[model samples]
Target: MGSPSDPARHLLDLARSRPPTLGDGRLVCIDGPAGSGKTTLAASLAALAGAPVVHMDDLYDGWDGLPRVTDQLDGLLLPLTEGAAGSYRRYDWVLQEYVEAVTVAPAPLLVLEGVGAGSLAHAARCTVLAWVEAPDALRLQRGLTRDGPQVEQHWRRWMRAEAEHFADQRTRDRADVIVDGTAAAPPRSPGRVT
Candidate 1:
């Protein structure tokens, strides 16, 4: 058994205890600012639950696409709610255009991770909403390091956009669980797989 304080374990337990809100499946929505470790937490939860994750990044049309994500999410999630396969046009960052459609079949569990994953329109359908966060400076540093300094302007713009979205959505206030993205992980025993 995992430790009582293990966030992934706790999240899994909560999900299992809840009634399915998305068709016959539970939807775990992980939303937070960029570089806030939302992706890492989603990966951990998905691995533990043997769930497939749909990244919001793939649903976004572009850097300025955050404001328009509800329509994209509707395309992806509405079908799933009816026990049908859902599909969304993936935005190709390099091509700067939407590419082929990605289909997601209904399952026992599905993880939606990234900004706008827990928008108001979809909140009622989420089994659990988790908000992960780190300090602004740390998040900015991480973003710059991963995306390169050349995209600093883009990062700044994105930061403002996400802040506005989060504020408008009251995402943090509605979160069922709030994780400290900067928290140090507990020490693991030798040879233990995370």
Candidate 2:
């Protein structure tokens, strides 16, 4: 066993050595409030795991529809665990509809990232779950900077929905790791093999 402060290093070691010690395939779920840099962190983690990321925002029908979004998650999760190739359609906000399809190939690790990414409904498939949080004020400012006037209404609605979802889901409580975004670099856990 090892100490509890080097998760990213351990994950990198696992990826470099193709050994069963890493256990079954892994799924890393990165969840956070809007504009918390979830996407940036997810991309870094994917690079570390030598895998690809599946963005949850791409699956939604519109600004609303949590049930349908869950359905989309179900469609992707099974095949990902079974090591089968799968594809999902991405909703295009600009086009006001689902615009195109994206294929996901099974990898040693799969990173699922976005708001609601770490809900308990997904716990079974997730090997490592992380919550990336920032001060609400920081998040709101970032949201405004990113969304612009065109998405102001949509962003507001999404924010309220996220607050409710996080209240019910309590994803932060179940997270294996909690990350605050103010650090120059993300803090890492020393390989705790849950």
TM-score of each: 0.92, 0.81
Clashing pairs in 2: 4-190, 5-189, 5-190, 6-189, 6-190, 7-189
- Model 1 CA deviation exceeding 4 Å by range: 1-4, 184-194
Evaluated against the true structure, the overall lDDT of model 1 is: 0.86
In order, the Cα lDDT scores of the candidates are: 0.86, 0.70
Off by over 4 Å in 2: 1-24, 184-194
Local accuracy of candidate 2 as per-residue lDDT tens digits, 21-116: 112566777887888878877776677667788888898888885546777776777676666776788999778798887888777777788887
* Model 2: lDDT of residue 95: 86
Candidate 1 lands at a TM-score of 0.92
**Residue 186 in model 1: shift from native, Å?**
9.4
Clashes of 2: 6
Q: Which candidate leads the pack in TM-score? A: 1
